[model samples]
Target chain A: MSISDSTILSVQDVSISYLAHRGKVRAVSRVSFDLHQGESLALIGESGCGKSTLNLGIIRLLPKTGRIDQGKILYTTRDGRVVDVLGLSEREMREFRWAECAMVFQAALNSLNPVIRVRDMVYDTAQAHGRHDRVQIRKRMLELFRRVRLDPERVFNAYPHELSGGMRQRVLLALGVLLNPQVVILDEPTTAVDILTQRTILEVLRELRAAMGFSIIFISHDLSIAAEMADTVATMYAGEIVEIGPVEELFYRPRHAYTLGLLEAVPKLSVGAQELVSIPGSPPDLIEPPPGCKFHPRCPFVTERCRREPPPLVEEAPGHRVACFESARVLAHSQPVR
Target chain B: MEATTSPQAVQSGWAAFWKATRRALTGYTARTLLQGLLTIWAVMTFTFVLIRQMPSNPVQIEAERIVREELVSYEEAYSRAASLFDFDPNQPIIEQYVEYLAKLIRLDFGQSITSAGTPVLDQILQYLPWTVFSVGLGLLISFTIGIFVGMAMAYWRGGILDNVVTALASILFGIPNYIIALLIILILGVQLKLFSVAEALGRVDPTIEPGFTPEYIGSVLSHAILPVVTYVSATVGGWILTMKSSTIATLGEEYVTVAQARGLSQWRVLTAYVGRNAMLPLVTRLAISIGFVVGGSVIIEDIYRYRGLGKFLTTAIVARDYTSMQGVFLVIAVSVVVANMLADVLYGALDPRVRVGKEQ
Candidate 1:
């Protein structure tokens, strides 16, 4: 990738494992992806599909029990330099986190300090990175609140609990952007709010990304929403990415069987009478995964070879890849998935 | 239409208060209350029975001792024991129980046979304040230190400071309170001559009778130092450990992680989010400690020879002062109940989720 092509972050073959009762469990298995400037990459998956693990692994925010078994996470800093985030010391990580890559976690309502005012929470980011003077920080905070469409004066003194769910998410988003990080990670940020509130948060995030030109790694289970918000969509299954492509290609012309199954699972409002389909089986266990292809047990077009060997992700089109041996056969046998 | 004024609004305000109060009392069960009362009664009764069942007969022992020491004749000692303790060896069990209940109802603890004619209640009242002061102060110091240090360690987890505090706290926890007290007295009191060894009663030197003056206060405090330090050092570890563990657990909560994601500093997150939530368990633990504070100071008092209730109880046990034993037991029982009640009320006040009256 060219240095000036606005590629903000690159995750190269990242694998994370956690200490569990039954030996080591691989939570994220050899995940690799990138976040370009001003673009959102939605890591779409079920709860245990390693989407959150991958996100956490990328930021080195995994819990103490979790370890980066293998990987290199490179972040393109503001001054046009690539820094390996995983290689940074704890102190260096603390310094780099908010200033270089801020994360807005899921359940933003509870993320705020119950005792502190909203403005203080926002100002904290600026202070940690030592980016601005007190006056400048205050001005930036007010500007952020305005950008997130909240009343600066009203929310400045209000505690987290005082604000509604949407407002809290906005405040969190404001905090994330306070330091003008090159990349922002939203880990299911809108999942906890109501439908209308989720829409508002999505719009605000879109606006922020547009205005600031920060790449976003938007983690969510809702495939439709991810399709709506993401430039690139990577569907994960059992700690592995089954498919990755442009938003339209992944949603409309899903190549992988698992991706097709996911797209089919979404309740389509446009299809007036069709019964909503769901993936037949549960995700494979992480501790002792299937010997062959992890999804072969669940894949409808599971062939002998598919059951005997794992398939590698092969790029069939430009920026379109699928990890399934029977992708062509499945596509020929059935109607277009979407 | 008047938009601001509504009958429903006034009703809702009153309803909200009532709801809060009811919720505050939630989870308290009749069974729990009965169980607590029964446990207290059992403990008090067991203590009373155990003391009475001791190998030595109080009347006989006192009579023989008085005769041997030439303090009183056999007749005088026997009469004194009978009149003072109402000791009737020939009386029926039922009759004795009736007398006990009657005396209990009248709040008459009888006279201390060992202390000539001193009232048991008066004896207890005399020493209760000293025990409360020493143990209460020690507990207060430990709690304050534990909370702040625990929070510091939790905030800077995995660092050298955290490891050092954890190591020191574990060491403190491993040693016994009495051992710590003995060591302190040996080092500070006997060797350094900074404070008096044992003999920690009265206002000051008997000749001066300083009585509550600054010099007297200073002497009293100096005397109390060994016991307080020992007690705090030994026991503070548990509080620190509990607070540290709870803080660590709280830090793992979704809310705290959210706080971090919201760009809260380590300190701000520790104080506002992690520490406050973690304090719930610590508060409950402190409340429990308060309930047992009197019972817990026995070793410390014994080590320092402090004129506290523990010392009085020990003397009563040795002298076979049945009346004083009963008096001490009753006071302890009442103290525990009152402390627990205070804890319950405080818990309701601190945690909005705790409902007081709604408890079963």
Candidate 2:
């Protein structure tokens, strides 16, 4: 570990499962990661790879059927004390949820109140946390609108239905950081917006993170955007972290075959290609995952040892970890850089 | 797109509207108006046959009873019974039916032989207002209480308040309306000494003279209270249960969850998003309830001895008075049809999704 600073939020060995109709579906299995102060960590995975489920579990917002089979999520509160989030009662959770940690959901347009104006929605969070007076709250809202590069007069008085998708997202971003919480979770915030809007929103997020100094948990399946935005990256497969390291290290020197396949699958703009390269085969079923290492059947470098036992996540270098027995061989076999 | 003012476009738009209307009406062909009318005709015909098939012919019973009760001669009694019942035993069944259809077309329901020669239509018109007042008032009260209480229960889901309200609704819903009415009569009328348990006709006491006065109006209202309460208590549970379930389902929608995640207060989310959407299903149920209210309660009216249409129907059945029975049936049929039509119009007004004037 680099030991830059203490982890602001630590999730230890979190495992969640849901009692589905067929059987128990393991959503998140022993997923562990830490979010440091003022740094962004991206959880990248395909659908059903447990990225969203892990986020829900961390916030204790999982649905009725889902249960945290094993895990502990510890957060450093504003009072300079760490507490387990799962231990709090529902009422206490409500009090701590938006005040200490807020979340920006994926569908921002539908997330806002259609009946009330944007000003009321933002003011509601401020009032809930008792953060500021009416005048102060309005002033802060205007400042946030300007910071997000939205017109305060036009948007503050408009209902959610009246605003476009990008504008609504900006409003949601404003609401999320209104209380200036220590941590904010952005769950695929840019998925529904256009490409230019996505870049603008990401830029705004970077600016906000710099000025506000709040750590971010950016959850997305788009690895390219994640690489561009995240400092640290965790790649998940079948509800388990196959690799985790600094973004640059993971991108330049990925050791796991699955990680390498994911990186190669991203279509490069500079390369002239008639078609994009896609990873063959689908994700493993979580209800009854493949025996031993779940990715063995999908891996091109599968061996008898890889099929017999799962490889634990071992550190291959400083801040670089890979969960594959042939990591050294895979790195040795790659072509030299130009 | 360019605005089209061509004749062809206008014709096509009209054609589309008519097609949509026809599709909506005939898509459910078995439940269409023609099918419903046929069913009504069959039921009325069966009722007519059943009444005539009863032992003790109306003409003979009336003649014999008049002779025995009034000590009149057979000849005089026979003439009086024939004139009152509009009957000649010599007439054939086919002829009678033809006359019946003709009279029906003319809106002539004949006279009530059992009610001392009163016209059957007049009797129905006389009792119509009392039924409307009592049942309509009861429905209003029940709906007001049911919707609000159900909303409250849904808001505090799984709490003690929800459990208690649900339990109460279940108990009330399980009990029959007559049983409820009887229980109320015993409690409020016999024990508490409040409000009259009987005398549910004419709006005011005939003994007080037929002019509007504060005392008369007060007595009329007081007389109406027991029946209204009884009817409301019997029917309110169903509305509450329905509204509660609908509200809970609405609360589970993605929109409601999104609203809450947007940092809306519990009340704002409940009222604006959950309540508004939940009310759509409740509005349809309420429309059905309104239709039933005009038809009146058959059991509750009987228990309270209220001379509403339901009570009159029962009396007609027992007396074997065919004219009076037919009259009561027609009144109820018309009332139900009109009530349902009114509900459909109101539904269209309330829900913008329902398009009106697309059908003749």
Candidate 3:
């Protein structure tokens, strides 16, 4: 299982379900993955593939309808104790959250308390954790603003409405990492900002990641963004990690047909007029999913056996896993020196 | 003329002054203020015209009443009505309107035809305070209670407490204010014999002279018990339901998720993020309510037989005192328009988004 001493957080066969109107929707089914210390893991996926559900599940911030069906979110705390996070009571959970692993939400612009000043909201969080020294908090806030590449003077006193979307996103980021937590879950942080602002935010995040040394669970639908931000990449399909490997290997030599399909979908400027190949057929209804392989219905090389039995996630190479019956044959056919 | 004079400094000074003036009196603010004034004028004009158009004139109504009650011949009655009711109905409508407008400009509301020939303005001043005090206090209490309780209901939505509050508030809202008044009078005043039913009928004990003394004040409050209860029961439901729905919608907002992700306590998130944001619509509602509340006081005053502007207006209507009717309606319209203006200003103050959006 590659159980290591330096593993900061790991999801061990974690499963989550949604009590939707239609009935139980298995959002995340037996997803197992380990995040090593100081290594960013991007849970890349198409929408409704349960990337966000799994991301929220780690921090126990699942919506009222969602629940952890089974397995544990094992978080290795500062004193070397591997604590089952869900076991903590609401009080302990509150303490463990933000202090251990904070979240940078997708709705960055609206996330801030619109009525409260950015300075006060940031100050109060610092105060709640016993950073009572007002001077120190102010200093830290200015430092954070600078780190996030926001002007402290204008933004600190101004309300959320006064700031632009990019500025608000930066403020949210500053607030998230203000406590200097071990992990920050950024769920599509740059989706709302312009391209220029997105680039600037990414640069700031990279700088912060280097300086703070916190691992990131960077969740995004954009494969290119995930490729840029993460070291290890996990591609999810229909609420399961269909393929996972290092970024370079996953991008260049994907074993799963879904992953290959996604790569071909991204419009390549270098490839000239090679039309982007889009995958067809929608995701199965979670309430009444087809038996056998969930991807078989949509697979390019669907075989009888693939339709008969679900392909288990198997490690084809060291630290590289693929869940497909026809991956070996397809890999052989598609093998080319890049 | 100093043609070679430095135009830049002179023009810059003038430009800066103009800029400052424009900021102080922004186009939006000016527009809103003018709109308020226009609304008040329109309402006053409408009330004046409508009151004048009523089927029964003061002289005809008075002459009929005199003929019915006293030993007066039709000739004597007509002569008395013509002398007593000095307002000439035979005058052209335009001339009367012009005269009314001039009186309106000078804040003169003409004379009451029913009461000891008091001026309409004087009668309004006498009764307006009572209605304001009772209705205003009730609204404030209900607003505070409804806001907090409603927010709590939203926070604990789909639970037993939420259902209970929702049901109770719904009942209060559905019933008419007078019916609620009757119910309170039945239950508290008559059934339980908690408060004296007789004392609940008036603004205060007739025996006690009207003064600011403790005794008189106590009498007024006791008398107010039933009417205020009626007022609260009638209005609190709308506030609770509105605030509850607002808060629930806000709770679903992504900002709330962000607030939680920031590790704020449930209380902090609910109150600061959810409650504060939700309360904005209510603030404007409350302000507009404050203005329209004088109108709301009409039925409640009639129910209690309290000597408020509402009761006085009712009496004036029954007596066909068109002057008093026009006067009271004018007051109501003015108050409502002014209240709306206050609400808009308050909105701009509380929400910078509103202010900044307009400026840009």
lDDT of 3 by residue, B1-360 (tens): 477566877999999999988876666767778787788788878877887788878778888889999979978897788788657768887887788789888888887766647898988898888899889989998999889989989888899989998999998899989888777778887889987777679888899887899999999898777777788889999999999999988988887876776667878777788888999999999999999877887877887788888999888887678778888898898889889888888887877767644545
Summarize candidate 2's per-residue lDDT along B1-360 as a digit string, tens digits. Answer: 346567778899999999988877776432446655665666667777777887766677788889999999989998888787655666787787788878888888888867756888888888877888889999889988988989888878878989998999999989988888877778876788665555543345667755578877787787677779877888889889988999988776755665555445567667777787677777777776766774567777777677787788887777677778877776666556556655666666655446445444
Report the C-alpha displacement of residue B22, candidate 3, in angstroms. Answer: 9.7
Q: In CAPRI terms, where does candidate 2 land?
A: incorrect
Q: Which of 2 and 3 is ahead in DockQ?
A: 3
Q: Name the candidate that leads on TM-score.
A: 3
* Model 2: fraction of native contacts: 0.12
Give the lDDT of residue B349 in candidate 3. Answer: 84
**Per-residue lDDT value at B15 in model 2:** 99
lDDT score, candidate 3, position A136: 84
- Residue A132 displacement in candidate 2 (angstroms): 7.7
Per-residue lDDT for A180-277 in model 3, tens only?
89988888998998899999999999999999999999988888889999999998988999999999888888888888888878888776877667
lDDT string, candidate 1, B193-284, tens digits: 87556455332344545676887778778667767777799889988888888888888787676555544467766776778888986787
**lDDT for every model?**
0.79, 0.78, 0.85
| Model 1 score (lDDT) | 0.79
Question: Model 1: what is its DockQ?
Answer: 0.26
Residues A1-338 of candidate 1: C-alpha lDDT, one tens digit per residue? 33345778888888899999898888888887777878789898888988888877766778878999887888887778888888887777777776777888888766765555676666665666665587888888888889889998788777676688889889888878888888888889888889988888888888887888888888988877897899999989888888889998777777788888777777778767788888888998899998778998888988899878889988987898888888887566446534
Q: What TM-score, computed on C-alpha atoms, does each candidate reach?
A: 0.71, 0.67, 0.92
